[model samples]
Target: MTRLCFLKCLLDSHAPINLPHNVEILVGRSKITKIKDQSCSRQQLSLKANCDDCIVEVKQIGINPSGLDGFSLKQNCLYKVGHESRIEILLNNYIHLIEFQPPPDNFSPIKRNKRKIEDEEITVKKKKCNKTPDKDSVLSIKEAMEDVWESIDEGELYIYTSKGVKSSKKIAAFDMDGTLIKTKSGKVHPVDTNDWQLAFPVVPTKLKEQLENGYKVVILSNQAPIGKGRVRIEDFKKKIENLVAKINIPIQVYIATGKGFYRKPTPGMWQTLIEKKNDGLSVDMDSCFYCGDAAGRVANWAPGKKKDHSMADKLLAENLRLTFYTPEQFFLGHSIANVPMAKPEFIPTEVKTEPFNDNLISDDKEILVLVGYPGSGKSFLAKQIEKKSSYKYVTVCRDTLGSWQKCAAEATRLLQQGKSVIVDSTNPDIESRSRWTSLAKDMKVVCRCAKMATTKAHAQHNNKFRELMRINHLPVNDIVFNTYKNKYKEPTTNEGFKDVIEVKFNPSFDDEKSERLYKMYLLEK
Candidate 1:
């Protein structure tokens, strides 16, 4: 028999049992008999037995079930029974009795410990599910850069770094056209001589601040009109000198016209100053800063119009300690009273390529091959094509390697996706171009090549500017230029290009060949 102990609470009414431990318990009704003493009638009755017997505990008693605490046993009340426990119930008038059984001696301890471990593991997993990356916390580039220059203030000690030297001095550089003066219908209106005299005083104030701060302010600009013979070099020089004298910013000025190294966005102008200082001059490039409105060439030509200095700015900030500030930001410290107000010219429209009205080319896939000598304006043209045409510009150097198998795999992927892709690379050899043509054929895609065949002299002249823009050395020797000139195979009718267009360097577009090239290459497919 199982040993058990039973306890009962006597009151005016019978009550159910409520036990703390999980035990198999049963309850029944019983009658309350009057005892000799009132205190004895209210006392709990207990029974003790051996191991085989069951035990029960009464919680409370009252006249109304709602008045009792534990013995109310309302709806939704739950009872749990432990292992090796049994319960019994007995019914009587206005009295309740309950019984519980004891567990057998052979219960397994190891299984109970394993069950506890499993329960703890489940609890830990539930906690981990609550932590994750918030959906709304992601940021875009423009918003992330909103407060980029908020900390900069006037009179702050600005340090400029160039060629590994750092200097704490204010170096002010100004862009001429829209910054210093306004140009109306191709004619530059002098600020002091014009009605906008008050607007021109900002230059003098900026210059005065620089002088007070012991700064070396300079003008590094590109005067392309001189190269085009629209403006004489002497006349341009006079205008610059007159403006500087009027502003009272006694500063050195470097202007690059036509094809020169010292130009903004290109480090040549800054590099030239640094070299001059190394020769015992007083100029300091380390304490110099470059401010410009446009990225590269001044003209709004197709290839020259795109911005190129974002990557260059990143490089300059890392290597030269030179900070590039936009005009919108530079005006934060200075007053806008002297700043020239000019609206940006909107001329060039996006090119559009129309598909054949009929189904001459039924396959939706197409391959666009961009061919040119290094710095022959290939990337710029490719970008224009990508923007204007329906061709997806795919970078082969970073995406696909020189290996034939890898190239084939990537081409197949693009073709399957139904995207017309433009491959921008130096495809100087027939074998390289042939691989792209073969991929197009295998994938049933239409293939075309837009060759940039600018003259070697033109490419070389542009190469100098490109080198300046890169502020680095040419990867190959002069042999690369010679090879590009001599070894270039003009795309012929047999070269597998469904359509082949050639581009040349022509600042003036009066020639029929130049006009045709522009229409064919720049217009669209």
Candidate 2:
């Protein structure tokens, strides 16, 4: 009679069956059936197992099933069966139909002497599975960045180059795209890997030198394209990896895919790195410096050159209370160049804080018109009046409603309910402002225009700041700003405004971040 020892536990589904000798075990969807010695003589079994349906792995060998072939459980002497510690192959799949009777109460696992040839074969397989992964096999960027930063939010994924480098005193933060790399196509935006080229050959040498000088080199970049589905996350990760390899230096990278606190100029990414990732070490703000290309300077106009995109990088440094450097100044040791702007002007009392009710009719419904450039603080002023003043008017802007006609329709509907309305928009030209004046005439209310004293330069600066910092909001680019400027006709008395109050472009936000942002929005050279 064949001496068979049944498994101690009755497997409701699939469970490990500790066998006594070298045996071929056949596993079906439900149960493990020991193949007879006669059946093993003929090669008959072949099937592919997808992980989604069935996942198999031998825990002792550290081998996870890859849904391929030539892998199966066998009673081999490599890890002796019932050596008190039996070879455990972890079954990570649903199983069914296992019928067996209990063994004798005194039953004990059988152990046999280890075999030489079979054990050597199993050892080779284990070594192949446990070896260090090569570069190409590394799937995600985070896998390589294992230790640098502890995840506070999995939604905001970040990558690091070397082992986590913690330093309290010094850090060198740089921006990625234009500052470090540019398109090979000689275009502003990248098309593919072929389009990428190093911005400066000195970048790697400089960064490596910084790393050796007791400074933690980090890349803080805004990668909104990743959030918008314009760029694949995996491809972006690979791009970062390629850059790091090319630079041949250990660096940590933080990419802000969407605009939020962590995005540049907000200082959230820096704050996280310092408080969470620095391993209780402190950052010396005085010794740290940030570098980027968006200094908002005028176009270089030279061959194969472009204007600074925005002043966001400088503003980001300002917000962090750290020393700031342009890419030219930091990497090339060049002096700061003259930043160009279109007719720069500044008025200290740009924003008027006086009572807006004084400009309002006491008991009559009024149609308040806001007239300014695209980013002239017009919306801010209108909202301020509606909140502080007793007017409590319903304010609407064309940007929010999609069009001027839509805004007028919404305002008309609200006015019919005996509510005062404020039309907040960059009513730059007479034709644009006429819609409001006409609406007021139809509503039979007094029309008042709050003309903001914000210059074109100030508006453009503000536009750049908003475009870089805001999420889900459409960017108000030079094309849109210039479109408005082309038809701008300075608000006039003939526009039918009962009273035109000169509203200064002052905005007071509650926090330092907002205060810093306000300064950046108005900053011009």
Candidate 1 lDDT over 1-525, as tens digits, reads: 533433233222333244334353333233433323332223223222233423222222221121111112212223322332222121111332233334435544232210110010111111232323232111111111111110001101011111111122355666555455554343344322222222244667765676668765656555554433345444554565456557754555555552323333344445544543233344544666655444322333233343322222322222335665544346445343443333212111122233322221224458777677776666556555555544454434312254445656776776677667667666776777898888888777788877775655445544553332332323223567777667667776477878776654333234564333222211000
Name the best candidate (by TM-score). Answer: 2
Q: For candidate 2, give the lDDT of residue 289.
A: 92
Instruction: Candidate 2: give the clashing pairs.
Output: 30-96, 184-195, 350-505, 351-506
Per-model TM-score, in order, reads 0.32, 0.56
Which structure among the candidates has the greatest lDDT? 2
* lDDT accuracy of residue 358 in candidate 1: 22
TM-score of 2: 0.56
**Which whole-number lDDT from 0 to 100 does residue 130 have in model 1?**
35
Worst lDDT 10-window in candidate 2: 117-126
Cα lDDT over the full model 1: 0.42
